[model samples]
Target: MNSALEILTKYWKHDAFRKPQEAIIASVLEGKDTFALMPTGGGKSICFQVPGMMKEGICLVISPLIALMRDQVQNLQNKGIKAIALTGGIHSDEIIDLLDNCQFGNYKFLYLSPERLQNDWILERIKNLPVNLIAIDEAHCVSQWGHDFRPAYLKIVQLKEYFPKVPFLALTASATPRVKEDIMVQLKLDNPQIFTKSFYRDNIAYMVFETEDKLHLLQQILQKNPQPSIIYVTNRKSCNETVHQLESLGFTATFYHGGLSSKDKEKHMQLWMNEKVQVMVATNAFGMGIDKANVKTIIHLHLPQNLENYYQESGRAGRNGDKAFAVLLNNPSDILHAEAQFISVLPDKKFLNLVFTKLCNYFQIAYGEGIDEQFSFNLNHFCTKYSFPTLKTYNALQFLDRQGIITLSQEFSEKITLQFIIPSKEVIRYMSLNPNDEEILLTMLRTYPGIYDMQTAFNLQLIAKKSNHTENEVLSLLQKLKEKNIIEMMAKSNDATITLNEIREDERTINRVSKYLEAQNKLKTEQLQAVLQYSKDTKSCKNKVLMQYFGESLAADCGICSYCISKNRKKQNPETVSDKIVELLKIQDFNSRDIQKLTKLPKDDVIFALQKLLEDETISINSNNLYSLK
Candidate 1:
């Protein structure tokens, strides 16, 4: 067998392992359960991939993110390594064939979701494979204390029953002490070797700015940096608006959100990655599995819900170890907004029960009989029918999804099914009567073979393309046809698909997951409060604050963070500070806050300098409370 370094050199082209990766890989190769807690961009994947490559049999890896799994599988395959991800949307027969390939096709790696372990047949098939290693990525999800906990992860421990002797390697980029402990216990890691790299990023300067005009601050920062960067927003609307704002200011920018099609996401990502665009204004969906080494900054236009998410997102910068910045722009209103977006939407037991009961009723799922059933769920329609608030109902459904009660696929699309109720000759005659609608009706007729015999689903875009009309035009013509009783049409706007993961017991179903829901909601509240405290903090070293949150401590302050820089500024001569304030006042009337922002000094120092200038009769406050030259 090749050494881990040899495998790394051959496949990854890395000369050596990073930090404790070598040690962790050695432990895994020695048939010992291992836990590696490395920070983001800390080379965590190598810890398992190298050891798995060195071993003889297929390495079974479990992850919660489908995108991450697909990305990793693609990366491995690009390296000429045999790997496959059994994510969702795969047919059972295909999964069986893939498992058989893993058994007999000499495949080196098999990636799958933790939820896949719930299938007994797959488990039985996996039991017979010569699995040399079991790797769990994002292992923190196994713990209830984790920020992104998934109940499906709790089922991952069942693999131990099948592969009792297989070494399980668990890896996560961020985990608290509590979460770390829970991961080990939940994974049943026996006497596991634990390796934790410090969360400190020496090259990153964490900064938080309080500003009412966030757009101005954003422009200033981007202008100063003028390098590849990511500006994170809270929603899709913000993504587009920020991009437009940047474009109007002569900045080359693009945006990415979950709502974007795969093609558009790839196009935007490529534009940013190739440096064709200077900035990527995106939601949190854009960064997973992306390994850009020279992102100069990660800026948050709004407050993050938790420090864990903030840390992971900000850590994207400076991967090549050059100086970079992680900036958070905040205002007084951001706190209230964060609370509303994160805390207020949390579904309690009552809300969960209501959503659960209503969902089953909405789908007409009889009591105790909805397992594995799928339905096209139109969230807006459902909400309007029940007079439920949209966001709250969506959150409730998400909670149900996280609990593995129902699998919600939020891939929005318009579903239209239609059939010609009249005879073919009558339909042709009616189409000829309406000359304007002739092309679209004929296009639908040609596109769907069984439209006249039965209600057939069709792509509106394809119909529009074939008929030389826009989707809206085609939809309008279809509505006209329905009005004229030429056809039976059923149209619904669906943003998600609901797959029942468990039998319908109504409230009983929700009652089973109530404890977890309550605990997670409380945790979310605490996490949000911590984030608010972090934003409001001005005296603490920003880097130290983040490190401490992740259960690490530093003996010295990071000299580059905003707090440290401000502290250093405070030590400047008072007269020099006053001179700078006077020069700013020389330009125009300015308030103390504006002076502090312009001078990049501490609040007290700015106030002291302003007082000194006033005392010296060099500047005076006008009726508007702005200081000017006297």
Candidate 2:
């Protein structure tokens, strides 16, 4: 095996490793558990990928997103390195075949979702493979204190016993001290070598604005900034509304959400990535594993549920290390809205049991009979039938999912699968009629073995390239083959999947995880309050506050955040503040808060400057308490 440096240059085409990359890679290679806290674009992947190449056996990469797994696999294959992603929706037979290949075929990397680790069959198959390293991406999910806690991540602990000698590498972009310790405990990492990069991005300037008319302010922001921006909303409906308004203002804007079809999501994403669109309006569902470097701005119309999410999302800006802006637009009512829509909607013990009973009845699952069973879920139809409020009911389902009672997977896309139904003789006969189809089918066979055995996720784009045919031509040939009964083709379909872990439980079985759920709700409320404080506070530098939140005591102000800029301007130039206030008041009588917005000054300075003007008799207050220059 080549050294890490050799492999880095040979494969990734990089001459150097970023800050702690070399040390982290070295630690993993020395057969030690490692935990790396890197920022979003901190090249965490290289810390593992380079080491994986220097090892003798396959590296098991655990990830959270199916799209991310597919992307990494495709990129490796494009670079002539064989890789595979064990995504959902694949039939069991195909899974077995793929695992069999992993065991017998000399493959280097296997990208898997944390949820997939809970399967006994999957665990069994993974035990048989010559696994050299275990890399858990998004490792913060293992911590109950983290914002995105996935109960499935707990199953990763079971791997240590199976691969006792293999080193584990856990990576996350952000985690507080409590969450950090929780991740270490939950993963059972043995004295792991920890590498933590600072959460500071000097290139990004954090700015927050409180306004009544967010749309008008958003327009002004879009008009002043560069292209290729992302506007994140809190809901799918807002995604459409924002995009429509932006487009109405004569901008090339598009919207994306989980509600959109797979094709539309891909279309809109590509349009933004290719610079065909100037802006993308989306829910939080967007911007995971996205590698756009030139995004000049990211404007959040609402506060994220937590600072971890806020930091991760804002880090998307200025990835190229260029000057960029992260702007938050907030309204006074957003706090009340967050409380009602998020914390208050959490289902209590009573609601949890009811939702469980209703869910079992909704699925018609017999008591103690539906264990390990899967079903396609239509929540809207179920809610309508049972007269359940969608918001509260959905929150209950999420609580159940987090408690490990069952697994609920939504927010997925369509995948194409092809299988051979008839004998090879029929396929040959059809190929005889069409020689070009013969070449394409042969190319698929050469590319992916056992396509005749079961349905598999065939790459249409890759197949077109290999067969020297356009994608339309490839689809046409597949349709031709399906029409002639040469192969069975499954068109892309997108929906949610729910798998019952045990029989639907009443109070007894449900109570086992009840305390955990209650703790989760309380933690969520705390997280919400934390973000609200960050958004509302104007006295401190936003970066310093963020760094302190993560337990770093770095006292230096970023010096350029909106808060610091306002603070410096106000303290240094009190005269300018008074002048701006007087100038604005001369136009029309206004309150102190409104004057702050007009002057873009700090609240304290606005108040102080207003007092100075009144004492100097330069401005007078009316009976309504609106101020004006006299």
Candidate 3:
């Protein structure tokens, strides 16, 4: 195989592989199961991608995030590489055709979500494909102990038996030692090579300021560094609230969370990526697989659930390797609120059982009825209308879905139009013959290029404008054409779907799912509490604390950090004005006159401070007499 260096330069446009990527790729290329622990922005995708290119057969990548699949496939397509994403967005008939293509087509990679594994026909077809590698992304979800664990991921472990000799590569940007080992065991890797990278960024200055005036602090940070940025909150409601606050501050910003429709989410993402909006106030759901590298800052309006997530979010900043900041604006009550969030996940078995039962009934699935059906789900609306505890219900549903009861997708449904029908000339001639429908017919032809190349639906408004008609007129004409078989139209996405496994005779299955749900709640609560401890732990260096949470051991303090500065200042001097002034001068060099003004002491005291500073050589005065840090 060619060197990772050669691959890096030839395709990825990087001078060299990032830390651990080279080692990880080498291991996987040698046909070893590999577990890669990288923080966000750690070049995790390249580990599997580079190897996929070198291998002989298609690398089947299992990913939980559908949005990430679309983005990666699109990026690969842009590079003129053949890749496909088999997700819930496609129709059953199309999925069959795609599987056939993968089996015989020249596709190098196929990306799929974990939920798709439940299809028996798909699994039957997969066994015949020449799969060379199985890359499990976000592999932490396979572990019961992982924070974002999915029950659907358990089926992933069974894939090894089906393709016993195919090498496996499990990758994740966040995983503790416990989660790491769990991933290895769950994937059933045979003597896997593990690559763990240090979770530290030298250029990212960490700041957590206690503030009551959050809007003011946010305003100051945005004004100070008005580059691309993200403000992360904990929930959808909070996401909107934070965006509203940022908007009121005269900043152009947008909000993103799991709650928005796919169309709106895509529009906002495009706006942010296109630089039409400089800020995106969102929840944790927004950052994964987002390739915008110029994000100069990431502000945490709420405490994240764990350091793994915190590290990943913070690492998104300064991706261009420039000096940036990860600021946390918190209040004293933040810890309490955080702790309350944790407790909300610590519900009892009875509570979980009630919620699970409601979910099965809410979806109108009798025992074992929704084995493989998929449907769209709206979390907040579902919880509010049904008067259920949202966090508890969400946890319960995740547990139930994991236990193979249903598929709960936490993604927005997207709207897509395909103008994938008739050639432009053919359409124009047909419209000419029907002069009464000419305006609407020509609108579709003019607005969508797909009409000339493939069968597809065009955006109603754009088509209307082109044909010199209103959106309604265009839609009516399209419907008429579709009924006459002259064209076809399909709206993009419906909600998530859950197929009941068919009516089961055993009532004990309910108890099994309930126990798992209760256990999940407790685990999530513990994870959130760990975050609270990280926020309030005063006895340790903040950076060290974050490192330790990610399962890293540090030998030294970050000398430039706030903790280091605070400690060094306290040890230097307290009673002596000279030492205090010297330390201040070292931090920020000031002229003797400016020192005099800042100290507000007598001229003699200022001179004494300057004399002490000069004696210590902590600072020096220029020939212009402007003092500066040495």
Quick one: best lDDT, which candidate? 1
Candidate 3: lDDT of 408? 61
lDDT of each: 0.87, 0.84, 0.75
What TM-score does each of the candidates earn?
0.83, 0.82, 0.76
Candidate 3 lDDT (Cα, 0 to 1)? 0.75
Span of 10 residues, lowest total lDDT, candidate 2 = 407-416
Badly placed stretches (over 4 Å) of model 3 are: 1-11, 89-92, 345-347, 366-368, 378-381, 402-404, 411-509, 569-630
Instruction: Score candidate 2 by TM-score against the native.
Output: 0.82
| TM-score-better candidate, 1 vs 2 | 1
What is the full ranking by TM-score, best candidate first? 1, 2, 3
Clashing residue pairs in all predictions, respectively, total 0, 0, 31
**Which of the numbered candidates is closest to the native, going by highest TM-score?**
1
Higher lDDT: candidate 1 or 3? Answer: 1
Query: How well is each residue in 1-630 modelled by candidate 1, as lDDT tens digits?
Result: 788889999999989888999999889988999999998888878888898888889999998777788889989999999998887555577799899899999999999977778878888999999999999999998899999888889888888888888999999998988899999999899999999999999999999988777888888899999999999999888999999999999999999986665557889999999999999999888798889999999999999979999999999999999999999999999988998888898888998898888888999989979776667778878999998887789888878877777777666556788888889999888867788888888888777878989988767766886788987798888888789898899877676678787788987887788989888989999999889988889899998888888888999999999889888863768888888887887788887768888998766778887888788898889888899998
Clash list (residue pairs), candidate 1: none
